[model samples]
Target: MSEKLAKFFKLNERKTDVRTEVMAGITTFMTVSYILVVNPSILSEAGMDRGAVFTATILASVIAILLMGLYANMPFVLAPGMGLNAFFTYSVVLKMGKSWQFALTAVFLEGLIFILLSFFKVREAIFSSIPLSLKKSVSVGIGMFIALVGLTSANLIVQGDGVILALGDIYSKEAIVFFFAFLVMGILSTRNVKGSLLIGIVASTVLALILGVTKLPETGTIFSLPPSLKPIAFKLETHNIFTWEMLMVVFTFLFVDIFDTVGTLTGVAAKADMLDEKGDLPGVSKALMADAIGTTCGALLGTSTVTTFVESASGVAEGGRTGLTSLTSGALFLISLFFFPLFSIVPPAATSAALVIVGVFMMSPILDVDLNDYSEAIPSFITIIMMPFGYSIAEGICFGMISYVILKLAGGKKKDVSPLMIVLAIVFLIKLLAPKIFG
Candidate 1:
């Protein structure tokens, strides 16, 4: 079994052993396990059953993560993405006044489109067309973006009354927990501790209980049967699938998901040193197919798009170098399906600190960007700034790509830009102008 396992995952080639991979997988699972709580809470606001969404979240993640491991043989984990879920709930259901079923139909169609794109190698070509600086910038940009998410989650940052953003009460218990947890992560990770991020998260949760930042679970509330998916599963409202709004919605879903998956896959692979000499992830086709399959399966099972999670970086930092890491995380998610409340009891501040630390891990690629080259620097800067500020990885990539092609073309460096890049820039151009044009 060990020989088959090592041979299947190329553990020896990757310089990772079974025990190291398993521990790294545990570390990865602990870091992203918060999504089991977070995704349901957000989607339930759209009138989906909280219990149902919870079940959907874990089940979808398990399916997707398994595909990533078995098919792609990459350590990337998949889940209903954060920003995309927000879009499903707030932007589509609340703001656009679409029914939740309508949103599901849009997601369903988008996933189908993605499958087609992946099968044809279109997605792979797009992935290869991105400039190296922009690819590195995606990592740095996601670092900042996820750090901002962490700060807000920990109440260390808040929406300002008159300004755009402001600091939270540093004296507050939540802030204190974040500081302590972050320090634990820093020191432990610096000391090369196994599962440093996981340990820090555990430490933060204990402190949260001690300081009353969050409460403990009610007694005897750990394990339970998963809620039925009847309320939300297979509930796509196809009546609007051919409408103008549907077209826009589906297009939006497809566009954002494509780039978001691209950005995430690129960033995490770069962080893991999994990229080849030409700055491309090996087996990217299989990776893209796994993501596409996850999205489609998630929509059918009642959830948002399931794409690669950036939190996978936490495991890579802990020395996870093969599909075994993703497989192990997937197995934990399956077990959690029966232990829902137990995982939910983990305080948001606990996971928030890990995200902030993961952000620091992702920031290393920034040094690779050539600041002296204005064309490269500006787009890279835009990509990095736009992710957190725009609150969308896809939006950041859109702006970065469009600006890169335009700047390169204008500077008589047209040769630097590829034909595919020009095509992508035009698509991004349409995206920027669509709101005004359609409105």
Candidate 2:
């Protein structure tokens, strides 16, 4: 079994062994395991059945991770994307007045477009079309947004009487547990712990139970059959898919999905020494296809957009360089199906810790934004602030793109703005103006 496993994943060629690959996979899974609780919690706010979303999240992750391991020969793992799910629930559903079904349709269409783009390698061109500053800002803005989500869910931040936001009761059990989880996660992470996020989650959950923030599940509920997807699977509403509103939503989904996967791949591939002289990953198309397929399948399975997880870096950092690592992580996601009750029982405070940390992780890209250039810094600043303030990822990107184009054009730096960016700005203008004009 070991020999065949080694030969199949080209372990020797990658200078890795089965044991190392498996360990790396476990490390990756441990680092990202918080998603099992977090994804469903976010999607459930969109009126999705939490259990169904949990099952879909697992299935989508397993399929995509397996594809990454087997087809792309890479160590990356995939899951329903964090910021994408947040946008689906808060932006598309709550703010845009779209139904969850409509949002799912948008995700489905985005996946199809992504597949075509990846197939023709057109995504690479699109990647180069956007400014690096905007890209970094997008990630940073989304990070802030997700962190805000964690804070709000933990009741650490509440709606203010006269202002936009206010502080919650810091002495509450939820607040205490949240801070505890944050401290635990921070300490473990600083010490180079392998599963700091997961450990913090568990520790916080235990504290929550002790404080009576959450009740323990019954014996039968702790380990049971996987939840059925019948409540939500294949529930996309496509009848009004041709509307301009739908177009905007799908386009927004594409924008977020595009950068999430591409940015993650660029960072992870670079770390793995998988990039060539031109700084492009070899066989990137295959990796992209895995993401596209995973997303399409996830939408049908009742989840949000699935994309490559940045936590794959945990595995690579642990000496994982081959597909076998992904395969191991995929297998673990499969095993988690039986423990739905345990994952589902975690309170928002516990998951908030993970999301906040993940948000911190996402903020690293801001270092790539060169603040020396006012032309770049201004738009980057707008992008980073608008996400949480506007309560819309699409709005942030749209405003950022429009601002970037306008600033460059006014500063006699038109050459810095791509034709694609200009076109996108025009569309953004129309989208923003349509509501007032139509009203």
Candidate 3:
């Protein structure tokens, strides 16, 4: 037992130090910190209280991420997912006219299905079925989507009646604050400063306060303990989960979250060298199970779907190689539940700068794709470009699949196309024509 325990922390064997691993851990945590507020912000808009949603966010992040470390042994973080929140708000609650409780119930049901499919290794098959071209496209497409998300979240971009959206005036207080923060972050990252995100955010908050652009709220009103296992013992509108509309919502949620998580985990694992020669990452099944359980747990905790974040790939690039990194991140999230007031004071500009920086970092994988070869290039290029333009992962995927099929057919190599690509192409055409199929 002593020898085994020693081996667990044997830095010499792994050739990685506590300092490096901890830095990697911090990198992973900062990358996904976008969720700490984004989840509650979205759910609050759907009529949930800030405190309750905050509690749910912390619990989901802590429990799900710890499970990823302990079970999957992957340096990945799980949290209330961004895309799924949109589905929960727009598809389930708004379009279906269902209560949030009923929508949460759908999330729970979808999670159960995800668990069972992952149990049967169907998750693995689905991920493997995505062509290399599509994977390359997904990476670049997601990069654009992430950058757009950063811009919109920071109010840098706003809607307009015409094709072009308005870019806010740079002289406005908000714009100036954001520009200053962005400048600081850009300099830090370009200089290869460690903990650049953390530094940039701290600097931004200080500047905002000094410039009188941000003010502290009342002390008593600013801080509170996040709810713990309280939600685990509660219930949502479970009885209505089987209704046709709810079922459709559940299916869509399940499809999107499962695929997204799969793509992110596999892609990150490959980059981190955690994958074997066969391109199989050890404990992938366990990771999927953790994700499914996290989604179920999120619904029970009064939140939307939970999934593994692609942001963890940032940590992978920094040399995070073990579960220790994930464990550190999960513990930090749990601790941050008490520091909500402090983090809440972090301006959107700082956070957006960090996100945009991370987006640029993740885009590095695009250069590895065989773009010089048209066979591998066109479909991937189309998919990558369509992601931000379409503003929907499903739409980007559809475009990729359609292009992959058409390109293969045109090249007189239809057999080279994956069967799933064929099916996706058919569905893409149907969705384009009917649009109600998703309804």
The RMSD (Cα, Å) of candidate 3 is 3.3
Residues 53-143, model 1: lDDT tens digits: 9889888889888889998888888999887999999999999999999998998999899999999999999999999899999999988
Give me the overall lDDT of model 2. Answer: 0.82
Which of the two, 1 or 2, has more TM-score? Answer: 1
RMSD of 2: 4.7
Off by over 4 Å in 2: 1-53, 72-77, 80-110, 230-284, 302-329, 361-365
Which parts of model 3 are misplaced by more than 4 Å? 1-16, 220-223, 227-233, 270-280, 427-439
Error of 2 at 439 (Å): 3.8
Candidate 1: clashing pairs of residues: none
**TM-score of decoy 1:** 0.96
Candidate ordering by TM-score (highest first): 1, 3, 2
Q: Which digits, one per residue and each the tens of the lDDT, describe model 3 over residues 387-408? A: 6777766566777778788888
Best by lDDT: 1
- lDDT by residue for model 2 (1-439), tens: 9999888888898788987788778767766777898899998998889989989999999889888999999999999987799989999999988899999999999999999999998877655566767766776776777678778888988999999999999999889999999999888878987667667877998999999998877775678888899999999897988999999888878877776676567656655666565445777888899999999999999999999986676677666888999999999899889975665567778767766776676677678778999999999899889878976565777788899999999999988988988987897798789889998
By TM-score, the better pick of 1 and 3 is 1
Per-candidate TM-scores read 0.96, 0.75, 0.88
Clashing pairs in 3: none
Instruction: Summing lDDT over every window of 10 consecutive residues in candidate 1, give the lowest-scoring window.
Output: 213-222
